[model samples]
Target: MYGIKTRLCLSVLFALTLISPAWAQTFDFGEIKSPILFQGNYKYAYRDPAVVYHEGKFHLYFTLVEKAKDKGMYWYTAQSVSEDLVHWTYPKIITPCDRNLNYSSPGNIVRKDGQWIMCLQTYPTPNKERFGNKDSRVWIMRSEDLENWSEPELLKVKGNDVVVEDMGRMIDPYLLEDADEPGKWWCYYKQNGVSMSYSYDLKNWTYAGNAHSGENVTVIRQNGEYVLLHSPRNGIGVKRSKTPQEWGEDEALLTLGQKDWPWAKRRLTAATVVDLTKEKRFGKYIMFFHGSPVNPKNPRSDAHNKASLAIAWSDDLKTWTWPGKNSQPK
Candidate 1:
């Protein structure tokens, strides 16, 4: 006969074995992959990735750039779906370059009232000039399904006659549904410094103020506080805020260093954060950003060098760990 303690231990072990599989099934960590999506063709480049999880899969949208002899270079947003976040299936373009407008940067996606809304930046087509152009503006599109999108609607205030302007130009728009205030929406875009606007109905928006001195803003709420991520001249930085209008002092989160992350050689920019607090598997935060290679001959032009997407994991949104054999936060 077995001792009482030994028999009880065995019973507990058997119970865990039976429940382990079900526990794993309950929490789905879809496609946990880095550079989670990339383009193999050298003729084309992919950047500015925005992700949204709906139903049972994650839908990712990114800006695709193709250079053609006759058409010059144009950008549009493409779509991919992943169930595990590790493996993905590329689908057709979700937002395509139309005759007169080019979908340049996909900022973010959100679902409300059983409808999906995507906010992005657009530049006039054929000319394809972004600098000092008055036609550039942030537009919103709606879709019942993630695949089929309606026409782009230029967002504006009730009485405004011109397209919304950030600083002097409009680019990289990020949308956030205000957490503290119900029925309020916030749009943060790149201008002089992360500029912001507020709307009650998602249609008419009024310029609020600058949140911080960075571009490519991504904000998330944690512990009743909001954390903002932006790309400055150096690399990615983090700021905290109790409200959407005011951001706290900036802290250096991730900076480009040759030895730190070789792939992120020259600089880092355009950061997007996904919170997985509800998921039992990850239970942390994932940040995706693009890194540019150093142009040795022209260090001044390094900002416009060839770039690729990279990722980092964070527990409390403060400390981050990169991928390697022995990775630690700086």
Candidate 2:
């Protein structure tokens, strides 16, 4: 029952969702059984979610928060569409509201020229007291299909092209479109550390910088090479560069050591990468991240708790192996 303009666009995104005290409670959080097939909350839906594969079908857009930061009363940014990527077909609300608060979050999707775009980060001004606030801007929207996606203006980000400026770091405006390099659209975003951008016509952008520090940044390019999964502190990391302006810093594939996610929490912050290349394995890759489980004190880990989604494997994205549940799907 979501129609009054998609619940008024999720009631204004909980006034300004930020999340982290661990996301305060209520478990299962949403599937990520290592790498594929999730059914937890209708298959890991919402709370820092972002994924795209268009044309063939694999569009997972999130943020239907009841508390991950409030985002209700008029909060939008929700979507779902997976033909066989394992169940999902319930949410609808797609980016509502426009007095200029510029609805923002970690919703990432990209296509280019023909359309289908989403860069997201939102909030140029609409005080919720999110500290210092650089005004947060990096928005864009246009769609040909993904069920009609529009309304996400202002995305220039010039003057300095921005290199790095994430403090407590929680930025997810990710987007990837380089089926080997066609039209050349690759954007691996984040707030402070992980960054990089390039576009053909997602409304003009060229900020290929950062990728040297380490933080929630997802990017994929199989066989041809280009992998970067960053966040947390130690393990669960990988940063390799070839184009995207030569990212040369990070170097660890999986972390939390000894390997064991009885519950989860090691793989850090919003992430997702897929490029099976016809499911060959080796030159293979699959990584989707988000953590805070492993009984982080059970009370649901609080801070805004609601982070779960896992999967890891890479023979040459610089090495990684968290084969738990053998990439689930039983």
Candidate 3:
């Protein structure tokens, strides 16, 4: 009887630890795997990854592109989970299959008021255009458990007066909390070189400002400073600022081992950083980025398909290392 009671008590404590954020530091997911997160083919391609570590598991969200015989190609916001970073569960599509509403490029996810919110964009290529039409706009969805998300709601990051149709072509929406302010939140998207908007309730937003930056912008607050990572033409670029409103010029452009890796020879972009420096298992900052293979015959195919999701890590956000490399600093 005593052994049974002790075992029950220990199980209850473990369950509580998994749900507590403060206990994340001690959680371990075992050894890391190869840098390739997801491999793409002619049938499917994965891009624009937005990842989060919750309850001792890594939940990765990205844009899943599928090729259809009758419809050509369509995109959906999909998700996959991994416990050890080596093996991942099969991806599950969470959004619709409509080409006009191709809800892809999930920037990132944030938790507010006991709910998880994810920001994304609608890339409408109804006419088989290479890029999204002018009707492209930013949006957000809310979820209670990060599994079942609400319908996509338009994010008037351009403000209430601008109107939805006049928002123009804005994509790659990333959400970040203010470094100094507690309740104030910022949404950074690609427009006039990355525009900024602030929101207090996540529903109503006020246009703040814009800056000269690249696409797929992801920001993190480190050492009392804001570190902004944006994707330039070939690789990911880094910029720094004390505040989100005012950002300095690009400091460094990082293309980690693209020259050596054949899979990333064409391009390496859409990088997202997850700072697990405090955690004992992954004591460095983890970066997940997607790359496209070189296709001389079909150059345009690299943009839509033949792209792959890969991983890399850094100790100081400057020098980097990957799975099979010799820990070369970039």
Candidate 4:
């Protein structure tokens, strides 16, 4: 009994509902437990978390340190798998510490041509001096499954002998597939300020230049734009760019001592931001970072030691909420 004009209007409304994209389910920030992953006994601590969702599970790789007198300081990549980001199962070391080298800052894990690749930074062990470009370099390994890995090999540039230039030291290498330029990859690392390099093979890189000024850089693509997150001055900041080479400006996102989150009170560093747009359980951006406590005796020196892994969630990649009762951003 409907008129022709009424039927046409109803048909249009039905078409619009079918074509419009479904909005992702909102995640409750209160459900996430703080210090999602940590280490306590045996003088062991976690730092530099690198996260990737693979095979329906979240794999978290991070720098595991052991402070012992006989062994001295050792750094290796340890892994944990979680079906739901809330609970995790600790696995054996993914990348073992070399006797003569310190394997630190596990980078991105990308699957290409049915093979898995993991990149990390390395420096000679037992060196009490600060890390220099001469001693530091990025190395890579390949795996069929996520468990066993090939021997670590130095990542060399096309013409240059070093991965990064010798004048500036580099660490915390994060790999991203260059969206603007197809078939190319971008590696962003800390060299004075966030430095960049381009590669086609992922092993042979060409040093580009400094993209911006930040450390522990993690880049993600959101809504066709690239966002870079880094830790500077014991806080988390963000930079945006349409192209990977030119980051416009910096904005402080999160900071320690601003909120009463106990785990992140002293310092917040080595952040890894995971984009969960297509994820089933939680379709929001999740940031995992290392937090440390201020040494009551030597606050300045001990503040940089990252002892635990903390997490925050965001709906729009701008506003974030923590787990605790006083989770309001200051």
Best by lDDT: 3
Compare candidates 1 and 3 on TM-score and give the better one: 3
Of 2 and 4, the candidate ahead on lDDT is 4
lDDT of candidates 1 onward, in order: 0.69, 0.52, 0.87, 0.73
Tens-digit lDDT string for candidate 1 (132-165): 1555677788999888899888776322554344
Candidate 2 is scored at a TM of 0.27
Report the C-alpha lDDT of model 3 over 1-330, residue by residue, as the tens digit. Answer: 459889999999999878856334443433454678789887898999999888777889999988777646788999999766777889999999887989999999999999999999999888766678898898999999889999999999877888787888999999999978999999999999989999998778999889999899999978888999999888999999999889878999999888887778888999999998877757778899998888879765637776789988888999987876765444
lDDT of 4 by residue, 1-330 (tens): 999999999999888877854232344555566644674334777888888877667788888876657735677788888766667886458666663567778877887778888888875556543342256767777889887888887766332574345434567888888887876988877776887888887766787878556678888998888888888877888888788889867865666333565555677778888888677657778888887766667776544244787677788888876666365555
Q: What is the TM-score of each candidate against the true structure?
A: 0.81, 0.27, 0.89, 0.83
Give stretches of model 3 more than 4 Å off.
1-30, 300-302, 327-330
Model 2: per-residue lDDT, tens digit, 172-233?
56666665567766555555566666766555667667656554466666556676666555
Cα error, candidate 1, residue 121 (Å): 0.3
Pick by TM-score: which candidate is best? 3
Candidate 4: lDDT of 329?
A: 55
* Residue 260's lDDT in candidate 1: 61
Number of clashing residue pairs, candidate 3: 0
